[model samples]
Target chain A: MTINEIQDELIADFAFFDDWMAKYEYIIQLGKELPLIDAQYKKDEYLIKGCQSKVWLHADYRDGRVIFTADSDAIITKGLVGLMVRVLSNHSPQEIANSELYFVDQIGLKEHLSPTRANGLLSMIKQMKLYAITLQAKTT
Target chain B: MMEKTAVLEQFDVYGIRKDFPILTRTVNGKPLVYLDNGATTQKPLQVIDAIRHYYTELNSNVHRGVHHLSQLATDAFEVTRHQLKGFINAAHDHEIIITKGTTDSINLVASSFGSAFVKTGDEIIISAMEHHSNIVPWQLLCEDRGAVLRVVPINAAGELDMDAYRALLTDRTKLVAITYVSNSLGTVNPVREIIEAAHANGTPVLLDAAQAIQHIAIDVQALDVDFLAFSGHKMYGPTGVGVLYGKEKWLDAMPPYQGGGEMIKEVTFEKTTYNELPFKFEAGTPNIEAGISLAAAIGYIQDIGMDRIAAYEHGLLEYATARLLEIPGIRLIGTAANKSSVLSFLVDGAHPYDVGVILDKLGVAVRTGHHCTQPLMDWYGIPGTVRASIAMYNTREDIDTLAAGVQKAASMLV
Candidate 1:
């Protein structure tokens, strides 16, 4: 599916939860079953610095498509990262780079992205897009 | 949650809990058992009302205007200085200078003291377990001055090694800056002895009381400390406000922290004279509402009584330490002989962030991560620990809830 298509599914998935917290519960539900990053890929070089909790992201390309894998020390953040990977993974690098991530705001996760580095959601998204841009550059 | 315990019987915690409105609230559909007091405290109703009253009735810029409202505001603001003077038993009211918070307070002393005393090859002493607020300022000052910053080591239990501290103090030592209580470890340093030893060597000391102001009684005069700093928000007061208490001799000798409106006597094309003590360091308009409300916070503490607070908090600490230790695979950090209400611990093979997230899900708020004490965390050879710090309002029931939360989190995370 395209990034926007996956994002719509995400919004619908979270729509059942009434409160922001119920959305987190759904996120945790997603996290429990999401594909975790490989142990070898989780290292200092791959670790995102801004998160209060530790988050490691790894990306690779296959047939001009970007595949993402990630993990977090905190489950809530893990859930959020899992959601991002599901949405952005298995897509063309160009699509990942240019796609507007509207589902974050639509599902009410956008308001929760604090300016502080400790929140790390924005930083994770930025890292994913940066990976896409870098990969797209090489492919072109 | 209070039992028939003798020490707790004297303290009316339930009455004190009523003063804080946030205690009655819930987080994530469960009752909020706030254990993040070390980060910041919940404001009592009196402090909230004081800030409200400031906006509704007597809000005005202080020490600048001559109107009736301005005069009232100035007097009320000045009264808090006197309140802090009594709060910490400082020798004089002018010794208290209100600043933004503990970080700003420390920077004022560091910058001022650096200009006057610190220079190339001079040594400064600080402990290993200090908060980033205390460490970074001195590091910046030392880097700027070409001076060396020396650290006093901590033992296995996290107490400052006095022998090492004593050896570190030398004729070349300019200043000894140490925390009155460890924000990360909960180790209470013997400031009186540290001050005395520093003074014997003719070096001045500054005590970072950011963690101790609410839990223990501090006497700048009794301890004979050269300078002391603490934040208002940590002591049931508003944010963006803190007190920096310095002796008269030091304040006179040091240069001003910032050049601004209230800190100046007069400004000219060529030369500008600085304002007198207290006001000299207080350069900006200041957090007028926070300053004005701080007096109510002090009053609220006084009403509860510090002795009673110390006893009750000590008991709660003992109770919590015992309870948290009961969980299998738990390793308690900072097992100092002298400690306060902070409990920093980690479960085996589980990250602190995971534990904290689960505790948070259960409505038990805790702080996780290195707690801005990266060096201390490095000393333990871990990323961080889940920290549960207590204030006067935290009760036995809170501990029970926290224990259950940790048990659940531990089982899942592990």
Candidate 2:
């Protein structure tokens, strides 16, 4: 599926929850089920430090596509990391680099993207896009 | 203890709550249970009205013009300094130098004192749990002056290591800068003891009272502290104004911090004469509104009484500590025997950020981060902990809501 398609699917899934706690419950479950980064890749070199939490993301370029895996010390952040991975991973580097993920706002999680939020989520998205752009550059 | 309970019993918390307009607001569709008082407090109507009054009736550049408004503005601004002198029991009104806030106040002392007193081999001492504001200014001063900065370590309970602090104080120690209360830990440091220890070595002490001024009554003369610094905003006042209470002798000795309009007596192309004690440190046009509004905050606190405020907050702290511990996976980060108005903790298998987000959804506002105390977080080997700092208006109901929110967070996350 394309990035927008996956975001729509996630948005539809989130629509099932009427309460904020229920939405967070689903995110927490997703965090538990995240495809975590390899132990070796979870070092400081891959770390994106935020004021409130820390995130480690690793990207692999294979078969002309970028595959992303990530982790956060925070479960909510990890859950959001899981969502990002599901949306942007296994896509062409060029396509991944240019994609706009808007489902976060639709699902009422846009506050995490605020720079003042100082969680790893905003930087995580930036880092993901940067990785895709860098990989695209290397491929071209 | 009995006296304290009586003070708490007599405290009119709901009446005090009505004074702060922000307390009535909701956050994310829930009734806001604000516990982030350590960051900044909600200003009372008195303080708010004072700000409005300043702009409306008394708006003029102070200490500048020979006009009626200027004289009125100057009188009102100077009134706050006199109020602060009485509030902290300082020796004179001239001892209070208005700065931007606590950080600005600390920087003023660090730059001015370092220039006048510190030499190449001189040492400055600070504690492990100091906020970055307290640590960074001295670090810059030390780096600039080729001096050394020594740290006093903290124990497992987040209390300062007094023995190590004593050992660190030597002939080389020029200044002992430490917090009166740890912002992150809630541990009220033994300030009188710390001051006494530093004074024994002929070292001047600068107390970072940014966290303490609102929670505890401070008497600079009684403590014999050389310097004390605090922010107006943290004490239910407006931001952009703070107090730097220096002894007359120190204020006389150190050079001016910034060379600007009010800080000078006369300026020439060749050499300029500096102004007197407080004016020397206050260089540019000051935050007159905040400076004036700070007096209203002080007045509000005075009406309630500091001892009464401290007693009521102590009861709240004890209640919060006990109530929060009832959660199955709760681990308090700061467990000092004598702490005031702060509770830092983490839940088992759940990150502080996750817990904080969950609590926010429940309309529970808390601080979840290193709290600008990275060294303290490093001491515990944790990234950060969730901190709920209390203020005069917070109640047992607030703690109950926080406890329920944390329980829900723990259940959902862990």
Candidate 3:
């Protein structure tokens, strides 16, 4: 689904859930819908540090776009990673690199995270984009 | 909620609780339930008053002052050093050096000791339960010096495996740094045993007592730790001020951590003579007010008595632990045989962040995350845990509130 369509669906589902559990379930379902990378791509190079969860990300340049897949040991954190993948994956490395994803405000995610977790998320996004930047440099 | 006047009788219980004005504040339009003491303790009114009184009455740079205010400030600042010496029962007052906090203290030792002693193939040992502050500095130092950093693993019950620690030690082991208590797990380490073992191997030991100094009575002489580091904020004192206690001989032998005005005796075109032990390590103008205020905070705690404080907090911990265990779907993370007042747990199928949010809505405050011990979280194979760390100020009511919030969150998730 396109970013706009996914966001619209998320908003609709968010509106439908009066309870946080229902909202959380809906978000987890959104995570399940995220196109994940195959098992073969999970390598040492894809490991991200400073995460409480074991998160691995793999990216491949296909038809001039960077297709990414990520997974984590923790469900909510994995869901977060999946949400990130949905927004940034399948876009050109240059576009992914330059895109200003206002992640904190966009998904209402930071409000739910502790100060440390918020910092961790910021670091995670930076690492992901750094990977994208490396791919962009290689492509150029 | 009991009236402040009625609760005043427990005052002798360390009437230390009365010194903290923030303790009187309300959250969610209700009385605040602060159970995150392990993260940081609330500052007492005496400490706050000292800060205010210092700025209002004696605001001036210390150590180099000829004028009255500067002299008074210097006297007050240095008085804290003496107080710290007595508090920790150190051999000499000059062994105490004030730093930004425990993180800076660990970094100082890593940069100085690691530079001077640690070399290629030399091993520096640390426990698995150490905070990132204690772990990262040594890791960075090891990487730079080509030394190996070996970790002493913890058992399933969160206690450090002494056998593993003993096996890890060798003639090549130069230093062993361990936390007195795990901030995440609340495990109270046998530092005396650890220190004796390291001493037998002719290795120096650094004790990260950041979490222990508040809840337990710290006697550096009894522990015989070569070095100790603790933060003021964790012990009801103001932030930005911490103490580093080193053996006088070791402090004198080590080079100055930072090069600046206060650390030196004389300056020259090429070389400079460093100041005496503590001053040599303490460079630049220090946090004068916080340092002085910390002395008052320490005095307040002493008035209440460490023994009394420990007994009260132990009761609260047992009460909270038992009540927390009764909640269905609630899993306690750190179940060490010996622990302090910290209680870390996870509600089945619920993110710690979500549990924390619900608790906050119910006017409860608890820490939710890795607690700066990501390595511990990795060991547990979980994202994070909700930590409720009680202090002398906390009562049983606070635990009830936390239990109720967890029950509510667990039901919603399961």
By lDDT, the best candidate is 2
lDDT of 1 by residue, B7-117 (tens): 877778888899899999999789999999999999999999999999999999999898999999999999999999999998889999999998998999999989999
Give the residue spans of candidate 3 off by over 4 A: A1-110, A113-116, A119-140, B1-18, B24-31
Query: Over 4 Å off in model 1, which ranges?
Result: A5-40, A73-76, A100-119, A134-140, B1-4
Candidate 2 residues A1-140, lDDT tens each?
88889999999999999988788898899999876899999999999999998899999888888888999888889998898899999999888989999999999899989987788888988999998888878878
Q: Pick the winner on TM-score between candidates 1 and 2.
A: 2
Q: Residue-wise lDDT of candidate 3 within B1-414, one digit each (tens)?
A: 243433334545334456567877888676788998988888877787899999999999998979999999999998999999999999999999999999999999999888889899999999888899999999999899999999999988899999999999999999999999999999999888999999999999999999999888988889888899999998999999998999987887788999997899999989899998889999999988889899988997898888777877776788789999998888898898889989999988777865776677667899988888989888988778899998888877778988988997676444
What value does the lDDT take at residue B42 in candidate 2? 96
Candidate 2, residues B352-372, lDDT tens digits: the string is 999999999999999999999
- Give TM-scores of the second chain, every candidate: 0.98, 0.99, 0.96
* Candidate 3 C-alpha RMSD relative to the actual structure: 4.8
Q: How far off is residue B161 in model 1, in Å?
A: 1.0
Docking class of 2: high
User: Candidate 1, clashing residue pairs?
Assistant: none
- The backbone clash count of each candidate, in order, is 0, 0, 4
- Best of the two (1, 3) by lDDT: 1
